[model samples]
Target: MPYFSRLQERPKIISKLYSNVITFLTYIVTPVLLFVILFAEEIVIVLFDTSYSNIAVLIQILSVLGLLKSFSNIGGNVLIALGKFKVGFYWNLIWSLVLTLTLLVSLQYNINLTEFTLVVFFANFASFFVWHGIILKYINIPYINLTLRFSLVFVLSFLFVYLLKSFIMFWPSQWPQSIMLGTYFSLLVLVTAYFTLLLLKNQKTIIFTLWK
Candidate 1:
């Protein structure tokens, strides 16, 4: 309501609000994305057993797609909100063409499942930048701020996970009955800490309003 209410009289306000929301969401989700990517093997093993072990790689790869889609979806909504429906259509068309053409080219080489997935992932990644570039023309988003926050979150999450992994690997085998149990406990703690800090930092802001 706030965004639409001010759409005509104060689009600058809407743009700022939308940019902040996107940045906040990126911070929140990037950690989870990193967690999933880093532990894809363990996750697959725990959830589906070793029978479908090969799917772990796919999960890790597609995890990136999830992040890209989040940004692209938000960008699409921004275009629509601004009544730039034609721009949104062009963005989608470009994405489709990128994915289809890349897949077709890869097929010529008789690519396997993993290779095929990579082609699709790369195509989305390529188109993501294009979509966001179009979005910038319509919305006064702080692209640098978004990039910096995303980089910071990504680095912090990666370091936390890496340290957790390192500690687990170095601990005496006799200390823990199961390494997997230890990993899960440590990850839970770290994830909790991450979110706790994030919430505390943004507590004064109307960050959650982005969802509504």
Candidate 2:
């Protein structure tokens, strides 16, 4: 947000911007992540081919990067907005170097997808926290609330998506016959359930204009 540009000049507004960012991450990205995690195998089956099912586990691990990189993305913007652009630049440079080194080292060994993904996840997650630490000196992030709320919503969203996936997998002959049908029904259930939960929590704030 452009408002972040003046954060140093107007420190008090930082909290409002941080709050909105957290809400956007919590309400929106978390659901997508939940979908990726719960249905990674089926999603993998559909997206590429059934042969790539092995990568679904990799995708599940990589899905955590959604939340991590969300913070990193916002932190990059904060650094640029605060006129500390080089910090963001150099930090990313280091991450790239580490990734390259990891890949090079792995080439010599027989690293599985899960093990490789774990390495990358730590690299990205550590960089995310480092970037956020630099930004926290300027921005007033609700660390505890953001963590607790996001974690709670993540579990709830995962359970919701898991239930839908389970029904699609184990239900009777009503199971969708084609991928197109299955996708449509999955989206229908997902969007409806997610918005319903949001509405039950905060109808006035979250569910407004959802139809529009």
Candidate 3:
């Protein structure tokens, strides 16, 4: 009977784990897609032959912002999972406040849209880290270990993408826009595939044990 109970619980455990994973992925992807869409105009302007100084500044700001946002997302998910509903709500509220304040300050200083957006991004990122810390504390999880693992994956994937982009830069200037876009996407796909394979290889031993 005890063995049967354990067997019965396995399906439920698996189902819940699957659901949480799906929810987390959805949360991460949706905001990213929305951010891209919302900033499309700024992105297009930057992509064209614009002032490299401003573009460089914008990129630097946005990159840090992006990192922060990613951290926040993971932190938020952890908070929700740990059953700290009030803490999560307050964290989100604080994030909104930070965004609003940053926007106001940026406007006051006459910052460009791209720069302003980057400020917003960093603000959100900070909020996410704060919330993440809170969630980890609540759940008694090791924050350093998880953060280092994610950082390793992120850096590796970014290097792959950077190299692919550099290679694309050497293509003919007269290449059709469609071709350029296709090449860009193909490279992205290849990078993703490479990363996926890397992840699988890294986890192979654990996966084999589970299957056996």
Winner by lDDT: 1
Per residue, candidate 2 scores C-alpha lDDT tens digits across 81-111 of: 7677887788778878988997779767888
**lDDT by residue for model 1 over 49-144, one digit each (tens)?**
778878999999999899878766766656666778798887678768877877888899998999899988887787788778888887788889
In order, what lDDT does every prediction score? Answer: 0.72, 0.70, 0.51
Backbone clashes in model 3, listed as residue pairs: 68-125, 72-128
Q: What shift in Å separates residue 60 of candidate 3 from its native position after superposition?
A: 7.4
Q: Estimate the TM-score for candidate 2.
A: 0.77
**Candidate 2 residue spans exceeding 4 A from truth:** 177-212
| TM-score, structure 1 vs. true | 0.81
Write down the RMSD of all candidates, one decimal each: 3.4, 4.4, 7.8
Which regions of candidate 1 fall more than 4 Å away from where they truly are?
Answer: 1-9, 172-212
Clashes of each: 0, 0, 2
Model 2, residue 88: C-alpha shift (Å): 1.7
The lowest-lDDT stretch of 10 consecutive residues in candidate 2 is 203-212
